[model samples]
Target: MFRSIRHRLALFTYSWHAIGPASMLRNSVRWSADAEARAVDSGFDARYGTDTNADLTPGEADILIDRHHAATMYLPTMDQDLAAMLAALPWPESLRRDATFIDLGSGKARVVLLAAMQRFRQIVGVELSPRLHLAAVRNVERVRDAGALVSPVRLVHGDATAFDAPPGPLVTYLYHPFREPIAALVMDRLVASLEASPRPAAILYCHPALQPGFHPSVFGQRDVFQLAVEGGRQTRGFLLGWSVWTNDAWLDRTTIPVPLVSGAGEA
Candidate 1:
């Protein structure tokens, strides 16, 4: 009995010693990421509050809009699968040449930059966060410096829900950009824009939890496209494509409030 107890104690002690360093390293990495996110977020807060803030341009450029949000909202870059998917999407031209790739709630312009590199002719990224907007601009510069064939990235700091749409088709990409209330308003604006033109508008949502509300409200239509790549790191995550109504195929749908995943109480 004594020998077995000693053996078990010895194993436990060794295990504790082995796990201590690993746990510390894991926590250190997490804290480092948190610190980096906070530093960027704080800089943005210092520059801009909730309202839109303008930027100092090198020459004649449109006055921009930038907003500041909490650091907890910091999101990592796009997954490799999605990046490759964006890179692989046949550069829409000729038949779909009018399609304009717009990244609504675009944080740091990661998606915009990637799509641009993949030959997206006209691209736009609307970001509300000041720090993220600046960081995204720098990221694009870095890509160009590194000789990456980056597409033209137009950064807008104004509220995406009310940003002006240039004359052309719209392909909005939303990666769970915002909650229902905010997303609903944005969707309404996008639909109104399309109604004025009567063109094809498709929303490629990476992580859509409230798309149901976004749809029917914006374009009076809804369609979900799920893409799963083999040997992809993304597990069980799929992109949601919310397409606008076409003149030939029309379907009037009702708007609905999208609830939070955890529950209504949390929202």
Candidate 2:
């Protein structure tokens, strides 16, 4: 309860600082209504037999709070947004079949479960919070029992910074999992992994923090990453955007007979 209050207060303070009192209040009201509507299962949960609708704040998860945790919150990726992200990947069907799909900071493994429905080589969810990791385990089991998973799912309970990307083609999904500090660490790890074992890789970042007040995303490394898709739409009064960053190696390999798929690159 106390943590929940603190979390709310922090959000209020941040919103006030960012948009002032009046606009903050207006956004708060609209966001609250939208959140409430989302809380109720809209057939996705019913069909999958999963409980991923709750917004699990750091406080609600009973986890230690740090600068990174404080900035992070758990909201399952919207079904439509995840679908759009998958669709935006430039990899052909053959490459996608051999690629591993990983979701960092996968809260309750919602994205993990959804990704399992695809024909990836493997699906992995790396989560830092123990509580959320356990929840993710249960959800994965439920999905497995229901025979809904095409690719085997693995849930790792650990920090994203320490996650070692398996060799071969990889696709990572991130939903603003942490602030810039932690994000930088995760990015370094990924770069190291790619360097150690050179391969085609891509990052799908939903609701990327690219605005002035927020820290810049590591995906902006132009020398290493090329913006493949950049677009967003208004959802429940909130403008949600996603950016797909493909490593230079992917672009280099696909430059020939593979035929590069076109998308709205970064301006």
Top-lDDT structure, candidate number: 2
- List per-prediction Cα lDDT, in the order shown: 0.50, 0.76
lDDT of 2 by residue, 1-267 (tens): 997787788666555544568776656656665565466535678887877776666656655665333346677887777889889888899998999999999989989988999899999999888888898998888889998899988889888888999988899999877766678788888887776677889989876222222244576543456788876656466666788888866547645575676778935
What stretches of model 2 exceed 4 Å from their correct place?
1-23, 36-41, 67-71, 208-217, 248-267
- Give candidate 1 regions above 4 Å deviation: 1-72, 81-93, 208-267
TM-score of 1: 0.53
What TM-score fits each model?
0.53, 0.82
Residue 20 displacement in candidate 2 (angstroms)? 8.5
Best by TM-score: 2
Worst-scoring 10-residue span by lDDT in model 1: 51-60
Give the CA lDDT, 0 to 100, for residue 24 in model 1. 43
Q: How many backbone clashes does candidate 2 have?
A: 0
